[model samples]
Target: MPQVQRVPMRAVKNVVLIAHDSRKQDLLDWVKYNRPVLREHRLFATGTTGALVQAQTDLPVTRFKSGPLGGDQQVGAKIAEGELDVLVFFWDPLEPQPHDPDVKALLRIAVLYNIPTACNRATADFLVASSLFHGEYERIVEDHAAKRQAWLAGQGRR
Candidate 1:
């Protein structure tokens, strides 16, 4: 079992936003509606979504490569690096993605890192409206280093 560590969150959050091609509009609508709350935080997004969000909301958005071209991996790396505070992904459940494995890996990394994530609009609303949104919050981080080392020792690789 992994151990838990309490970590403090900053008042201003670093948020990652992503969406499938078909769900981009939905994300846009949601963001626009939540702009008052979202605008206060640092925003990151995959290519076209970033551009559209910036254009429509007039809010600054940091852009990564398109998801199919490794944007998901970029976000995952940031999560591993402990740079992101939240993930708002509006993925299309009905549509198949060419980089499905990457998407799964991204979600897994988020879970492993104990980042706050919202998969749909309702959850997104809750995240944004929570008192922790504008104040300091503590998160329980799952520490898996000892588990990995143990497994490696059992495999005769440590």
Candidate 2:
């Protein structure tokens, strides 16, 4: 079995917020309502969403490129590098996105890394309200490199 690794998270988290065009207002409302709790953490978002968030909520957000322009990949990269702690993405399930693959990949990475992810308002609220969200926490994830090495070695024997 591949070994697992524990990544320690600080009390103040690095949170990334994302929303589809149709869901932007919903996300904004949630952010506005939770501004007090959210202000305690570092914020990040994709282009237009970030701008809107900053304007509406008066919160500072590190902006990446727009989703279709590769912002989802940028956020995924940060997750892989252990830079992002939480993900609050309000995606439109009924609407197909131009960058659907990127969105799927981002969600996959978040699950693989075992980070806290919230896909809607209710879940987002619960995530912030959880005791774990306010304190130091340790995330356990599979050691990917070790698993890859084992698979590679087995392939060579075939």
Candidate 3:
């Protein structure tokens, strides 16, 4: 039997922020209101949103390139590397994104890594208010395994 290596994701929290051009103002407002909670951990963002947040909040943010210009992929890579924990992306449903696949993959990686994510204000409230910043993020490796097993079982049933 081959040995399986488990890479422990660090306890550090990394929150990602993204919003469409239409939702930029909304994102800024959310950041302003939640600056105290948000400052407890590291922050990552794509270009314009990062610029906006940094200018207003004085929050130290690490910025990737523009999302359409491969920033989403960069964040996904960090997730894959077990470097990121939480994602607070405010995506606009009304707009069609040219980088939809990249965005979708980033979301999928978050799920795969058991990273917490919030796409809207309601979920964002739950995430930012939770004790995840002060302690460890709840990661369910068994959930991933169970879901895969269930999928295989259902396939056989079909």
Clashes of each: 0, 0, 0
CA lDDT of each candidate?
0.92, 0.96, 0.81
For model 1, what is the error of residue 158's alpha carbon versus the real structure, in angstroms, after optimal superposition? 1.6
- TM-score, per-candidate, Cα-based: 0.93, 0.96, 0.81
User: Stretches of candidate 3 above 4 Å error?
Assistant: 1-12, 142-158
The 10-residue segment of model 2 with minimum total lDDT is 149-158
Clash total of candidate 2: 0
Q: Write the per-residue lDDT of candidate 1 for residues 25-139, one digit (tens) a residue.
A: 9999999999999989999999989999999999999999999999999999998887889999999899999999999999999998898999999999999999988988888
Total backbone collisions, model 1: 0
Q: Which regions of candidate 2 are displaced past 4 Å?
A: none
Q: Best candidate, TM-score-wise?
A: 2
Lowest lDDT 10-mer window, candidate 3?
Answer: 1-10
Per-residue lDDT of candidate 3, residues 27-47 (tens digit): 899999998888877988999
Clashing residue pairs, backbone N/CA/C < 3 A, model 2: none
As for TM-score, the candidate ahead, 1 or 3, is 1
Can you give the lDDT of residue 71 in candidate 3?
92
Where model 1 places Cα greater than 4 Å from the true spot, the runs are 154-157
Q: What RMSD, rounded to one decimal, does every model reach? A: 1.5, 1.3, 4.8
